[model samples]
Target: MISFFKKFEEEGILGINRRIGEYILPYNPREYYPLVDDKWKTAELARQFHVPMPYHYGLVNTFGGIRNTRELIKGRPGFVVKPANGGMGNGILVITGESEYDNGSIIFHKADEKKITEKELYHHVSGILSGLYSLDGNSDSCILQERLECHTFFREISFRGIPDIRVIVFLGYPVMAMLRLPTKESGGRANLHQGALGVGIDLRTGTLTHSVCNDKIIHLHPDTKRKLSGRVIPCWEIILQMASRCFDMSGLGYLGVDIVLDELRGPLLLEMNARPGLGIQIANRMGLLDRLRLVERIHDPADGPKDRVHRMLQEL
Candidate 1:
């Protein structure tokens, strides 16, 4: 037991308690959490900073709005329905396509290939409005967002759902990043706990180095059977700069920025997390202690977003 603990200490593995005490509590402010907690509010803030995000068709705040879900979508072949305050990819519904019946009622197809009627879709929206999947379990609003097509790079490696990049930024500097690839087991959602794959990415270069699933290291994707390493992320610099800019936008010293590559839109910000999980360390086979300390010691508040990204990546 002693040796096990000593090894972890030598490796600088950050445990949960240390993460919250040393990073979250000291760097993140309570007042600024709301900006990232509510997806709808984050969209409004993204517009102010000119940060690109998924297009929102509309929001359903009340149970009555659930009845208008179809009208709000306005015949979009593909769209996403999620709670404004949801977390961990819960309360998210993906409508991949739809066909109308002869009677004019629409039948929707989910990403999983299950068919859903208009009534079932409305019920899901109503559940979101009731906060069934919300972070705080309070009444929540439902967001109707544009479903982005998978980028070609990810489509080659991922199983079914959209793959997204998770960037950990501290003091406006990007310290580490991971590519979250959706898997069939995860129901096509890029969530690690749901069996999605987390691939470590080099901060300086966009090349993938290592991958982990269910806390175990692996090279080939479980479902796709493709080699996970050596794949370089396209538009790497732009993604880093955009993630750094989010810290400036949210005013959170420690932050997690989720970005997705859209086939048409390039990189789009999904949302920000003030209390990002520590699973990134496992994916990268590294600890956040050294990087966090470096940021605390050398970060220049006067530097612009681009400068912060360049300087930090070089330093790391």
Candidate 2:
């Protein structure tokens, strides 16, 4: 065990214990955790900061609100139902489309084209409200969100779901970034733990550099067979600005800003994670300790979001 830790430090990889004690614990205050943990709260903060995010169709907190699920999604072509405090993509239901019949019976289509009835959808929301997927064992509210269309760039690379870019911001300076692509095994969710692909991005050029799945390196996508390198991310500068601004909005020195590209809207803030994972190092084939140490040495508290992003791009 001693030698194993020695190897981790030799590689400069940020282990869980050190990550918490050095970065998360010191940079992230416990009081501001709710700003990032609860998706609804994050959305409210984004509104105050003028940061773009997915539209909130409505909120379903009570079991009684579950009855009006159809009303929540009335005029929309598709909608997403998810626990506001859920993590790792658990208890997320995406309804792609719906068809109404003369008898008033309607059928909903999932991302997989699987049909779901209204009763079944209500049951799923009920389960979310029961704290089944919440981070804590407490009742949670469900967020009814507008289903965004994937940008053309990601649609060609992703299997059947949207891809999101995760930028790790330290003291309002951008440090590392990775693009998470969904696969069939992940049920069309851009979550790395559930068999999705984590592709590292070049912070300087917004280009793809490396990729990994389950900590194993791969050059081509498992299903698409597309070469997973050299593709440049669109709206890269705007995305970085949004990520840096989130630091001010949330008041957390260290956090992960998840952003997605919409067909209409260029990039929308998906959510923020105060305790971001370390798998990003494996995907980038580089340790985070050096980059983080560099940021700590030169990060300026007086600089604004745009200035911070510029410095990181030039120096990191």
Instruction: Report lDDT (Cα) of residue 239, candidate 1.
Output: 99
Clashes per candidate (backbone, < 3 Å):
0, 0
- In candidate 2 the C-alpha lDDT for residue 210 amounts to 96
Candidate 2: C-alpha lDDT:
0.91
User: Candidate 1 regions off by >4 Å?
Assistant: none
TM-score of 1: 0.98
Best-matching candidate per lDDT: 1
lDDT for each candidate structure: 0.92, 0.91
lDDT for each residue of candidate 1 in 1-316, tens digit (9 for 90 to 100): 9999888888888788887988889888999999999999999999999999999999999987787877889868699999999999998999899998899998899997888999999999999988899999999999999999999998879977899999999999999899999998999999999999999999999999999999999999998899989989999999999999999899999889999999999999999999899999999999888888888888888999999988987787
Stretch of 10 with least lDDT, candidate 2: 63-72
Q: How much is 108 displaced in model 2, in angstroms?
A: 0.7
